[model samples]
Target: MTNSSAKTRAPLSRPIIAGVVTALVGFTSSFAVVLTGLAAVGATPGQAASGLLALSLTMGIACIVLATRYRMPITVAWSTPGAALLAATGLVEGGWPAAVGAFLVVAALILLTALVPQIGALIASIPASIAQAMLAGVLLPLCLAPVTGLALNPWGVAPVAITWLIFARLAPRWAVPFAFVAATVVVIIGVVTSGKTVDPALLIPQLEWTAPTFTLGAVIGIALPLFVVTMASQNVPGIAIMRSYGYEVPWRPAMLVTGLGTAAGAAAGGHAINLAAISAALAAAPEADPDPRRRWVAGLSTGISYVLLGGCAAASAALVLLAPPAVIPAVAGIALFAAFGSSVQQAIDDPGERIPAVVTLLVAASGVAVLGISAAFWAIVAGLLVRGVLHLGRR
Candidate 1:
């Protein structure tokens, strides 16, 4: 009896450790982008902290519920790409309240996708090249932050960049997380040298709810683009990754859970939560467990870790609030390098779609706003119009 119990406990340990690693990697890697995105859309520092906490709690709960129910290593995450879109779109016609409304709209759209099969099919019918091109365009300005920050604040940004480059060669998986570590160090040194004191009260986690106020411009500019990005870059890819790992995720339940999670968090400033993309493999892969059936333990562990990490959201947000200018943005940029590369690659992969894709990229990268709508919406419009014209009369 003792020997059998030991064997059972021994195999379980590996997956539990993998789950903790997944949460750590997932949280530390892109929380900066979330903060940056929230701030760009007119969230105050306190509000941004609230957003982080909301996302952490909601997605953590989501992972726990889905993984346990399906007995698969299904993980949920805050939408990193959607956050980037918010950052690029900036303050919309109706300010922060409007942005919150846009978040709610995205939630409704996601729920609709789950309830009505045609909605998901419509989103799926969007050309991959065009979708990826718009994302690439939106990401371009952000990816330039490190280069531009190096020029503007070399002392602060250099160390982060060097750390990232070193780890990128030695351990690619940890490069961005290491860069964030370096940035934290830089921020601490800056604080010490400048004799600035951080408020202890600010470190305590709290949610600040905003009553949403919808506007047409925000709907078109922020809500639509955010939904598209979350679906194309996060949710869809997340499903494909799980399928590759031999887990047939129940589509409706997954959508319903994430959509409901997004709705619950929207008022607290979270932009969106969706299925995990890049970090999905961390929990689902064979490395998580020799036996695939046991890997769901990792997913449960990840959820619990994230719930605990939610307690630190305020501290993380305070750090970003206190960091010297350009340092945080630099970290955010390094964290997104993989995503930007992937987007650009997919955007131009097809010879036939190259022109429309390029058109979308150029329009989105231009940062043009027409009558309060952001470049992202215009990029989609331009790409589809060009494609329709070029393919005229083709069967």
Candidate 2:
């Protein structure tokens, strides 16, 4: 609190601020997707809260550990695409327990990818453009939530949108974070004026465990697809984000930690945790700190923030529960617009990969479910098939 200490820490404030912004963006943006996914798998509200807490803690630890060990801004996040896949897939034979089992299976598969180099190689072999396309496809519909909010609550969404637009022009780096602040202000005013309050108990940490049940249907319908989507859409892109910023990341240790983290989360109704994509960019970007070597502080700060947020899981969950249905999604969509734009551009960047990438995008965007499998899994399959056929023709 003293001036001298404050002056000393001033130089490091940018990365710290960036890290906090990244944590807020990641947690606020995709948590609804996680809740919806857990609900679809038959988790009760309490179970869902516990799941969110578990995931937050695991991912926070992963980000902190990996970033510190490697001296790189390695971020971790729950697999948003995998969560969407869960939302689309619905409940399996044994309800929540079966879903838990499926989650464990998916975690084990992720671990296998670390232990068995061939599986990781196989995933890496997929054209990066196609993977980007699939991620874009998965994110496209959610990004429209702000538009949906505009129709449903223009008064609430307009100011947020205008703020983002203004900042994006004047201070591009802070656009999303500024918009988030604007929206948070609006929400607080509405809550206070409306005289609506949440129970303090919701702010307390609680843990719940489900006895997992392994069923063939759950494994086939949920596990495989979840693994594929989390690996392709989240883990791969997350690594690419770090590399895009010129960081050399070791894949095996990262995968092992995330795999272990996902499994730890599964015991408490969480789905999957993987490397972060968008938030990783925030921490890894040069803007986080002038000295690139010290940018790991951003990841460390993000991890610490996530842990704090996890402690407030109950209150955070309650806020989402009380908000206007469209509000959460709109805010989340706004936070994700930059990420969506990047994915779309990357998806089509390579002319040779364009067709397959487009195919993947279209399939993922379609949201088609066939025989209990989600479109994301099919998108990858379809894109790879198209790519293989094209390769054969060249041969």
Q: Which candidate ranks first by lDDT, i.e. highest?
A: 1
How many Å off is the CA of 127 in candidate 1? 0.1
lDDT of each: 0.94, 0.82
Top candidate on TM-score is 1
Model 2 TM-score relative to the real fold: 0.83
Stretches of model 1 off by over 4 angstroms after superposition? 1-10
Q: Which stretches of candidate 2 lie over 4 Å from their true place?
A: 1-22, 87-94, 181-197, 215-221, 240-247, 284-295, 388-392
Query: For residues 1-395, could you state the per-residue lDDT of candidate 2 as single tens digits?
Result: 68975565537888888889888878866677787678778988788889989998999999899988998888899987777667656677778999999999999999999999999888777777877787788778878888989999988888888988998899876776677667767777788888988787777878799999998778877887688778877787788889999997888899899999989989898899999976789899988986788899999989989988898676656666666547667766766676678778988998888999999999988887667666766788899999898878585
Q: Write one digit per residue (lDDT tens) for candidate 1, span 1-395.
A: 58865576447889999999999999999999999999999999999999999999999999999999999999999999888888898988889999999999999999999999999999998899999999999999999999999999999999999999999999988999999999999999999999999889999999999999999999999999999999999999999999999998898999999999999999999999999999999999999997888899999999999999999999999999789989999999998899999999999999999999999999999989999999999999999999999989998
Worst 10 residues of 2 by lDDT: 316-325
- Angstrom error of the Cα, residue 220, model 1: value is 0.8
